[model samples]
Target: MRTWLRHHQYAFLVALRRLKVQPFSSLSNLLVIALTLAVPVLGASILLAAQPVVREIPTSPEMTVFMKQNSTLEQAQAFSQAVGKEFQAELANVRLVSKEQALKQLQSNPSWTDALGALPSNPLPHAIVLTLHETPDLVTRADSLAKTLQTRDGVDSVLLDSEWVQRLAAILSFIRIGLWILMAGVGVVVIATVFNTVRLQALNQREEIAVARLVGATEAFVRRPFLYMGALTGLLASALACGLALLALTPLNKALSSLAQSYGVQLTLSLPEFSLLLTAAILVAILGALAARWSVTRSTQY
Candidate 1:
């Protein structure tokens, strides 16, 4: 164990020295890798930040059944009660709002006060806000329930409040798929970048490798430095990418906060966990290094 540790320690130092020997080339490679890695990091951060917003959306009412202008508060309340009784298994809650209550709510809003005050009488209809139980059959049941409510005598219309939420969910699904494809492409690029770098280093030290082999050095010993070099390169690049992603998110968070504030939503953007990001970076680095080492071994053997 001690001998293995010493070997790795020596390889690690050699890798560091090799990078320092060509600072400009190392920096250029690091920057390219960082930029490539940053794209996914930025995407992941944005998705994490938006997770809270998505969670909040599902907690609200799924649909609203509006009553006709002539519908009385008693009729609206009866309808809400009937809905609660009929869809008890599928509905979480059903709340009836009278026209008078709707008018009061409209009056409470400063923006709507002027328009509402000009009206001779309250033109607002009664409504029933429905909170649906989350289930696999939620969409189908909700649609069926809405259609049933629409045919009722006092119901003017049944509006699905969760339609926009559904659309947003679909959009997020697409974004996730796109991000996965993008990450796969970026991973390929990273592996290729490391492979090329290791190949160049191998070619540069061809005579040295040959001399080591002639001296009875094992293939693992010969490949150790290049593997360490690839890992070190990936590690540094990933760290830089994380930093860049955080910096980019600062402005985005500010913009998102401003937008949320303007819309009167209590929203705050969150950063990705450091431990998670670091673990991912390490894994990616190790994978990239292994790929480079494999490519180098194949080429040298040929």
Candidate 2:
């Protein structure tokens, strides 16, 4: 165990020295890895930040059950209660809006006031607004309920108010899928970059490796420093990527808060969770190191 620890310490020091020897090349490789990794990291952070905003949107499927013009308020209220009882599991709320109340609401809105005043009689009908519980199948459930309401004698029309929400959900799904693909592609690029970098280092130290092999050095001993170099490269790159992500998000965070304020919603850009970021960085480093080791082993074998 002591020997193993000593070898690892030596390998780590050698890796550090190798990076310092060619600072320009090392910095360039680090920058490339950092920039590539930052794309996905920043995307993931933005998605997390936007998740709360999306959930806060009043996009739960709702049905506006317009009653027949001749329907009495008592009948509308009775119908609403019946519907609420029937869909108890899915119904969030059911409220009856009398025709007069609907007209008053329209009059209060400047956009509808002009059109409403021109009418000789209130053309609005009683409505039962059915807010449904938020679920993955909310749109389908709302449509089913709407169909059931349409068959009732007093229900003139049932309009679902979730089409736009459905569209927004679809858009978000597509964006998430695209980000996953992008992240996967960037991961492959990182591994390839590290492999090439380590391969070049192996070539540069050809004489030293040959002498070590000639002196009875084990394969593990021969490859340890190269593996360490790859790991160090990945670790530094991840740190740089995180710094860049934070720097880039700072101004955007301020802009988003301002926009949220305008919409009367409290919004902030969320940073990537520390544990998740650390795990990802370590995994990436290990992957790069393994790739480099494989490439170096193959090269040295020849």
The most accurate candidate by TM-score is: 2
In model 2, the worst 10-residue window by lDDT is 53-62
Tell me the spans in candidate 1 whose CA falls farther than 4 Å from its real position: 1-3, 67-110, 113-140, 148-156, 266-270
lDDT of 2 by residue, 261-280 (tens): 99898877756899988998
- Alpha-carbon lDDT, every model: 0.84, 0.87
Candidate 1, 191-265: lDDT as tens digits: 888888888878888888888899998898888988989888889999999888878878887888889888778
Candidate 1 global CA lDDT score: 0.84
Clash pairs (backbone) in predicted model 2: none
Worst 10 residues of 1 by lDDT: 52-61
- Taking all chains together, each candidate's TM-score versus the true structure is 0.79, 0.81
